[model samples]
Target chain A: MSDTSKKEFKRSFSGYVEICENMPTGMITVRGDLNSRKLKSAFSKVVGATLPKERKVTLAENSIAWMSPDELLIICGYDNVSDLMKKLQKELDDQHHMLVNVSDARAVFEVSGAAMVEIIAKLAPVNVKTLEIGEIRRTHFSQVAAAFWLTSEQRMKLICFSSVADYMFDLLKTSAVVNSKVGEF
Target chain B: MLIFTCPYCGIEADETELTPGGEAHLKRFGPGSSDEEFEGYLFNRENPKGVHFERWRHVYGCGKWFHAARCTLTLEVFGTYSAQTFEPPEEIKERIRAKRPGWKWRNFS
Candidate 1:
């Protein structure tokens, strides 16, 4: 509960588009056998969020995004993360799984506008033109590991390591320069 | 500019998103082995011009290690497979032979 132990920083860059840092969010890394019926049902009970398909996200009271073949990230309210983690542990105690609270290890951001696709294209190698709703793209921005998904229409939510938040913010700001839109997407 | 599809994640990742992990399916020869055998294991490597299988890590994405089979000269990717094998799969080898018939990769022919 002390401010000195916190690395709280917020910044915004409004150019041809709006780019802003998001508040801290709850993220839990759940790695296990995703094909298990018990894991699926327990996830629904713990957060009421379904287990998402590969490279997709399930949006409920809490959102669950598939990070890899056997890894899913459960996103909930930061204050409720511990409670949810305990619930998940109790639900799947007998099953083989690894659960870790990664809320403070990442920084989330939002880039919204018509040219949001082009802004991401400037840094990543992924083609977002055909990205369906709730589809996640786990790619790197220039040199750092990052992932993003379309949380809603015309709004993309991105997450990167906390240590690279400043660098990612600068990349987002530079890519969102006025009139620099490539218009390909 | 080579794009490799990660077998685990099922995504075609650009070379920038991947980190090459040298050749794949290398058998280790440690102590008690003959000098020639250990030397061959550590120093010798296949440099086939037609089909070569190598290891790659999808570091920026799923962070899984997978094997890729491709040509050393033309840079054409025959296919990509999992890294959980001591040898390329039979189907992958057959596919490579179909592309470059009589292509011999070390003793794999």
Candidate 2:
């Protein structure tokens, strides 16, 4: 194949549900005892947002989400990650924690439109309709482990391991097409 | 597909997101324990058709281990609770009793 053909082909669909891959961003996984005041404050200061409550995502100057009781995922500009990690390490030096740069390990997709919730409902077991505006959920999307968060009333972000990016894209595309056809019928 | 409420995240998770960890509250028979105790702990399991307690992990969700009270025959979930305890909480037993009346499992009334 030509180099042009080898280049990553971004897929998107616009219909009752819109699905598209999001631009790359810095992604970091932080694991520690979030109950500790010092750890919480340092994390909030470094990420520019407090660690969100259980099953929620906090969006402020930066986006920090609660992945688990002891884990948080931070998203920010790709350029800011290195310095951010360094600063966080310094701040948390005395504490027991783990910081991992997972920017290249995952793919992110954004889905929107009027039938967005229904489309996601087809793939995941979550009741996306009841998912609060800022809530996030970690679940499987058609057999692939995935997580999603509502970024706006009409938009949500889905993320999964990069190894299955193509599979995730295909599943979302198929679901969108099937849903749009159902609307027509 | 079973739905379980994760105690740590306080969110309902589908069976796909949760990994079943087998029967909960198994007493470990470690060093100095009798061979019979070790064998029972390692191999024997209470496979009840009615009310049963099992371990589940919200691996894809909050990554916490929890306990679920379920009926194996009917596939009806009684309730889910934290995995920290050695036995199902009193409240969960009470709920199961209210639903299954005259149920008997282990020592839980």
Candidate 1, residues B1-109, lDDT tens digits: the string is 6998889988889899999999888889999999999999999988776789899999999999999998988889988998888888899888887888988776686
Using Cα atoms, each model's DockQ against the true complex is 0.76, 0.83
* Candidate 2 C-alpha lDDT tens digits along A54-152: 778888767888898889889887678888999999999999999999988988899988667776778888876578888888888988989998888
lDDT of 1 by residue, A1-185 (tens): 34522654377899877999977889999999999999999987878977899899887779999999999999898889999999999999999999999999999999998888788878999877667879988999988899999977788999999999999999999889887877787
Badly placed stretches (over 4 Å) of model 1 are A1-9
Question: Roughly what TM-score does model 2 have, to 2 decimal places?
Answer: 0.91
Candidate closest to the true structure, highest TM-score: 1
Residue range B1-109, candidate 2, lDDT tens digits: 6888888888888788888999878999999999999999999998898998999999888788999999999889989988889888888888988999999876676
Model 1 chain B weakest 10-residue run by lDDT: B100-109
- In candidate 1, residue B74 scores what lDDT? 83
TM-score per model over all chains: 0.94, 0.91
